[model samples]
Target: MQYVPFTPYRRVLTLPRVRPSMALMFFARLPMTMTGVTLTLYVVSNLGHGYGAAGIVGAASTLGMALGAPLLGRSIDRYGLRPVVGVCGVTSTAFWIAVPHLSYAVLVVCALPAGFLSVPAGSLARQILAALVPAEQRRAAYSLDTILVEASFMIGPAAGIAAITSLSATVTLSGIGAIFGVTALLIFLLNPPIRNEDELAPIGSVRPPLRSWLSGRLLATLLVAAGTLFCLVGTEVATLAALRANGDVGWTGLVIVVMCAASMAGGIVHGAVKRSLPQGVLMLLLAVLVLPVGLADQPWWLLMLVLIPTNLLCAPTLAATTETVSTMAPPAVRGEAMGLQDASTRLGLALGSPVVGFAIDHSSPAWGFFAAGAGGLVLAAFGLLWTRRRRPAAVAPALAAAVRARR
Candidate 1:
């Protein structure tokens, strides 16, 4: 195992952000979540686009993310977070203002660049957390970030959907756009230097292509992990909608809210762990317990109960994965590593929806949960074996031992 470098960081995670970098992140996400799912709804329902056309636009958003993430991260690595985030916010705002009127074709074109440049608020937040926390404690830092993002997802879409349905999609788009504008301003006004910049070499005459950072086994593994998580997101939400359990559209969001709340609560509790546990054990437990998520019937009252223990471990699992990525990637390529992680999750969501939706259409809506849980189990097992194989023989035993302990 490679030793993770430690930096002297203290508790901003424990206290309020004096500069409130997280606030900037919260606002920046308003458009990202809204655009990906809710805004797609607006295009199909309000705008003159077929549902199939919405799929194309969604693909464009993924394409934009895949194309843009590494580039944006590299820019942050080279120039600074301030400039890239500012540019992203500006372009995203402009895209929103245009979203209401643009032809499906135009929206597709715009989504590519817009999604790409939109300040990777999530990655930026993680970067800040990485710099702010001591390396040993980075797991908790990432858990906190994940909790915040889960909260954001819970709230952002509800607000966006309500704004679009009652007021107008245009109004919502403008509102979200304005939020991004504010985000740009906040990031610039704060102008906090990222501590991780030292990890990257000074951008000299030549910049490497996005592929250099992403086209590697390490990046591929991290992306796979991230993609799996978002697949859970997609599958869970779609199944809830298909079942129409509990109540109405609001209920669908509420169901997800329950799950997100569980995740956030889990993160809080997980952060308090002083003793290290075997990761594979926790992951397998989570995977097995989560198998029941697929069986949630109308009014999934028991789902929360089932996830109480399972949920606590989820964020930490992912956070640990993030830490691993950070440790594995050279500093010069850190941004690309993060970008791939982000892009993978985004594309995974887009991809997962169709696959799970198909299951709901044919087999049963409940299958989504089982698939996610089962899929997670398979992947976690893969991760453990993969990690062991990648390690030298001596290190492999420790990893295998950890896996055994987890199982």
Candidate 2:
């Protein structure tokens, strides 16, 4: 088949509501990407706490989000998007607005609820994309979404740091809170579809049982998704450690931008192409490529160059994972399924940081890279084994029926 590079993206963009929805979601996610770093800065700079204390609040919030995602998603499935968004929006806005006014202890206590009610923007974006874009073109849609994610990360943290460093934390945080409220209101007003028209269930239709849709294949996909995050986060921690060890900390931003650029390039190609690597294979390559990055840690630029190959797979791996989950999940429970994907990725991020940090602390940054790759390999291996084991069990009923017919 004759291939046109821009055709896939054009097709996806041409779909009804895809363009405006994606644009709104892009802006909506900016505040989300900023919140973590901004909160850490606020805790350390304003509240007179150390990084460790700041991390406590951050960890609490992460835990809350990890626990809350599936529940919020289920709520969306049952009650629909607006009600959940309304409650979460008001709660999140109230929490962020109240942050600068609270004592450190109170802040910590509030962090969990704040995170629990934080709008499920990322998952919502994927759900909307799945609803708006047809299944056949979802790879492109998700790839584009992943590219936007990369762009958001590249912009959000730096902007947050700049804002917090220049303005008072009180002002910056209040601004963030205001942004949250405004974006939430915008999302409510837009009210994007979460399920395709054809896939919409009739009134009183029961959602399929969890066991029926959450198949072994889907579980394996989630495992791979988690592994993808594990490797990426670990790589990031290792990179920072290596840079700090080599006294190249000042160049950190540049190195990160380069890494993001590589990932964006890869995402572009992945979306524009007719076919690309499977999620498992892309994730495996992502993990494997990072294993040797620490060897080039001396010159900061060299380390950045070595990091590119692994990062190049980043957006593609993420996009493929989203596409896979969207495909495997029925529309009725897709919100919950995407929520699980979010939880799994968060768990991976939660585990990656400390585990890789410990490795870098005890041994060397090189070992951190090794640990990250090894951890990813372990998850990927387990997923592979799980699918292989289920294959025979899945085939057994068919085999029995064939044997009876022959008899």
Candidate 3:
């Protein structure tokens, strides 16, 4: 809870290019943030499908995005951002435009491919932040990015739901497609400095092996990133379960917003803190907060109060994951690194509902909370141990490379 002045954040904003790009990215990411919720609603409401069918479609999309992220990142690293943006933009927009008319079977089958092209807006924004700022300024940048992201979550799903409520899911889904198109156009015009050839190896220089990028440190970070989301989303599912059990479904949305506000507050503090806690420490704190939430399910208010502390750790964990990936990845393959991070997040979220839902279904709503906490702790323990054991051996190659480079 140590506070640093906002001086760092002010300086970061003062940068000529950072502000506009961030603003655009903030809007650009909205469509992406809204998709999961909006799509689920569409399938369940508009298409006359059961929750189970909607779940499958949603899961398909998540799987596609997870599979696409790394490939897209590598393409961005190799071929640059514009081409990749163009391809995804065209394919995605076309899919959405035609999708509303398709049969349910066709829609289900297309979900995976459509998601594969879902604008990589989130990853690209992180790439911009990493490339634009120096190491010292990056924590604040990451914090700011996390805050904006929280804001997007706050707005995106609500916007989608509202659109569907007022108009139609078809119109909303199609409109989101247009948003993706606009985002692509913006990225193409802005041509942000994600892949400055000068920053990377010379054109003819040999690329480092993928093994270098997938070092023990990076792998651990990826796992922790996924685990963090696992807890967050699991808690979300658990909250829903608790509400359903109590017949308080109407409170679900407001309760989730309260949780998001807690996370936003934590992000604000995390950014303002002079030296943030290590990621491992943050994960442990998160686990501690969630562990007792199960006991608080008696009353809806109690569940909200219990979730506050656990949710507070949410954005900080995500921001730290971004910062770690930024620091760990070489400039040459930073896009790929960010992509992998995005993929890990998607994978964790895809797993969260099922894992928590099963726990709640088979046992009790209380077990969902317990399972979330236990899962987080188990993952954190794995990462911490793996990192400690490999610490010496992991740095050897980099050290040798540094020595060679200095010669």
TM-score of each: 0.82, 0.97, 0.95
- What lDDT is obtained when candidate 2 is compared to the true structure? 0.91
Sliding window of 10 residues with minimal summed lDDT for model 2: 380-389
Estimate, for each residue in 264-326, the C-alpha lDDT of model 2 and write its tens digit: 999999998888999889988999998888788879989988998999999999999999999
* Runs off by more than 4 Å, candidate 3: 1-4, 195-198, 395-407
In candidate 1, the residue pairs with backbone N, CA or C atoms under 3 Å apart (3 or more residues apart, or in different chains) clash, namely: 281-406
lDDT score for residue 302 of model 3: 82
Assess the local accuracy of residue 232 in candidate 1 as a C-alpha lDDT between 0 and 100.
65
- Choose 2 or 3, whichever is better by TM-score: 2
Could you tell me which residue pairs clash in candidate 2?
Answer: none
Q: Comparing candidate 1 with candidate 3, which one achieves the higher lDDT?
A: 3
Return the top candidate by lDDT: 2
**TM-score between candidate 3 and the true structure:** 0.95
Q: Over all chains combined, what TM-score does candidate 1 have? A: 0.82
